[model samples]
Target chain A: MTTTEPGTAEEPGRAGPSRTQRLVMGGAVLLTVLLVGVIIGMLVRLPGQPPAPPAYDSVDVGFAQDMSIHHTQAVQMAAWERDHTTDPVLRLLATDIEDTQHGQVGRMLGWLELWGAPTMPLSGRYMTWMADAPGHDHREPGSSEPGVTQMPGMATAEELRRLRESTGPEMDVLWLQLMLRHHEGGAPMLAYAADHAQTPQVRNLAAQMLAAQTAESEYLRELLAQRGGTPLPL
Target chain B: MASGKTSKAARRNTPAPLKKNSFPWGTVTAVVVLVAMIAVIGTYVAVRSNEQQARAEALAPFTPTAQNPDPSRAIPGIVIKEYPGGSHVGPDEQVAYTESPPFGGTHDQVWAACNGVVYDTPVRSENLVHSLEHGAVWIAYHPDRVSGEALETLKSKVTVPYTVMSPYPDLDRPISLQSWGHQLKLDDANDPRIDQFIAALRLNPNTHPEPNASCQETTLFDQHNPPPYQPAPTPGTPGARAEDESVDPSRPMQTG
Candidate 1:
């Protein structure tokens, strides 16, 4: 009886685990696996990691695309005036505009390339991103075509032709008139981008453009007054 | 010892009955947590895939492929040709080009200033062809055929850095868009294909000979007073093909 009793007691003690113990162990293992997975996911998304690229329709991208095109025209006109102007003051100003605007264009294009975005506006329209801003209309008056809205303050083919063909005082006065209006037109775009762009670099660039253009506008106004020329209506 | 054994057995049996009567709250909690985790992960995966699909769908039509070498080919009425690049003709000479307002072949040494310029006068075909080599889209309109609001509508399509618009005298079509070896002739400025043509071929590395070539005028070719357009010289004209070389149509020009 004694040997049988001892054997029975040992059998129950040696049995692996109770049903409840097995269930709890299995649950612990699964919980550990999930916890590890979540930790890894968090690490991957850490702020120290490189941020995701800007979205295609993001303010940073749209501003860069539109501003690059705007700067291109400014560079073109400045380059021409730089080469053709006899007045030292106008020549200096033209050179400055050409060099600065061209460099800005290169910077914007580089960003677009890195972001895998099209350098040209995908919609083939200008300033569409600014439509949501208060008191802004991105469309030109009577522009019926979907993708052919002319950017504000752009010199017409006739005006550019006249600037190219004119000489002496007439050329200088016309150039100042056109460029002053161009700067005035571009100021609002810069201000909007400066205030609302998502990327820090883009915002800084826009802010810099506003400051430089503001100073340049003052100079242009003085030069126009000296030349007895009035600014063109925007 | 027997009494002790009996007491231990009685204690184990007592707890077993109590455990069975009580609800298995721990097991229920574990199952619920596991189900919630799976649900969260599944939702995250689904959202990520949907976003990727939308982006792919947006870009697929415009993306170039080996089979569909030029995406613009899908547009109705687009004319595709194969032309050799880097062949230069002198300022005074001209190529007996197969196509009028030629898209490619034996261009002038200097490329007309593109960079979104809209020339009021007709620009030289040879120079504009050189611009094509540099990946510029030349929008040519017959002065008599397109005017007034139509002309203004056309001019607005020209965008900076790689687009040019000019009058092409004696153009067979009202509007012709030339980009390297590609051409799309259109009757209406409002045609959607015009935008499609520009989006597909302007600076398209696959379509143009010189992908790195500049659109800016680096040489003495004046933008305001660019060379006037002249008729292609008649076949067998002396010095017409003097500097022309046999370029491989399949090969892209080497960037200098």
Candidate 2:
């Protein structure tokens, strides 16, 4: 039923008129081919150009935002511990955490700022990306998984106020407890990002962070025990 | 049958006028296709142009604000940042800078003493960047690559105030001369262009954001022991590349 005969009826003289029609058709096809070649050339060169960098909601982006804010609290609490603790080991550890975490904070913020992504996700939407895993959102415990709704292990405003206003051994104990919980809360995000971040650098940073925080958490628990402190219930 | 006969007569009478009207449709079809082709070609050209434009901006963030804006007349140095920046950094804080042996970006509150001091060890990057903001020139060399006569030749160039010389392990070039908004990498100890670069950009005022600011000051950091150069253990980061004398600037050096 599909045939080239529809246009054949319109051709009056096969020799003269058909030749002219064929020439016009050839010209149009050639023009289209030339135009298509230009499109292909542009596409072939596209990957070589660096992308506009990460956007606000991308995994690499969301990880940087969440971790930067997460690290800020650690630095702050470490400073609190530095001010409150008298134990030489605890003081040294606080100082170490303060120094290195502040530096890492600087690096992370530097990357986010350079990438033009927000330093933190807009309020309320934090860690919602973790919703990707099934059934765990309910099983995650505390606010979502560790404690509180903002992020895993994040101290509530009331808790931060308490940590800030408290003094002496109480302050030391509070600082240690809060920091330990914070690290534990941060674990899921880091673990997720380590396996799933789009950028190699993001993955590399997550790996470094996982190792460092793991070691620090172990040290944190040991110090808590040395002070005859028990781990806070999640 | 009578209507068909009358229509056939009308068709015969108006054949030339009808043919003329039909010719315009063929022209219109060709016109439509040509317009479509132009649109596609235009879109591709625009995207390609935009990509090149973005790359060009990324390649040179800081342009030479020399008294003369002529590129050829400008001192020969690769563009570092394709953008201009002036962010203030805290004196004690660590800045994750975009360039190693930074030319200019956010810098610490205090400037390093550029009062004709030739440091034997590498100075803190924060202070060095601050000094550049005050319109001083910094000459950084690899400790292993340039020494003895080459070292002396470089030092002689830094005898005046607002100039300082030190070792920078991260530099891919053996020596790089930096003033505010400009830097030139020299393979040889005695490139005549070295002097030209200094004379053109140093305290040029046109390039310096604060030309009147003093370079003679010091605080916190010791005169003798500048922070030791330590490369980051993480490979491919700027800190990791700090210890290696990465030779080609064209190759991706650490950005943050």
Best by TM-score: 1
lDDT of 1 by residue, A104-156 (tens): 97798667656655667756677877877877756666875432356777787
lDDT per residue, candidate 2, A139-169, as tens digits?
A: 3343543212366687765686687667777
For every candidate, C-alpha RMSD to the true structure in Å = 7.4, 18.1
Task: Give lDDT: candidate 1, residue B122.
Answer: 89
Best by lDDT: 1
lDDT of each: 0.78, 0.66
What's the TM-score of each model vs. the native?
A: 0.71, 0.44
**Candidate 1 chain B least-lDDT 10 residues:** B15-24
Cα lDDT for residue B68, candidate 2: 36
- Indicate the TM-score of model 1: 0.71
Task: Mark the regions of model 2 whose C-alpha exceeds 4 Å error after superposition.
Answer: A1-37, A45-47, A135-148, B1-36, B43-256
* Model 1 Cα lDDT, one tens digit per residue, B103-158: 88787788999988899998888899899998888999999999999899888777
Superposed Cα deviation of residue A131, candidate 2 (Å): 1.5
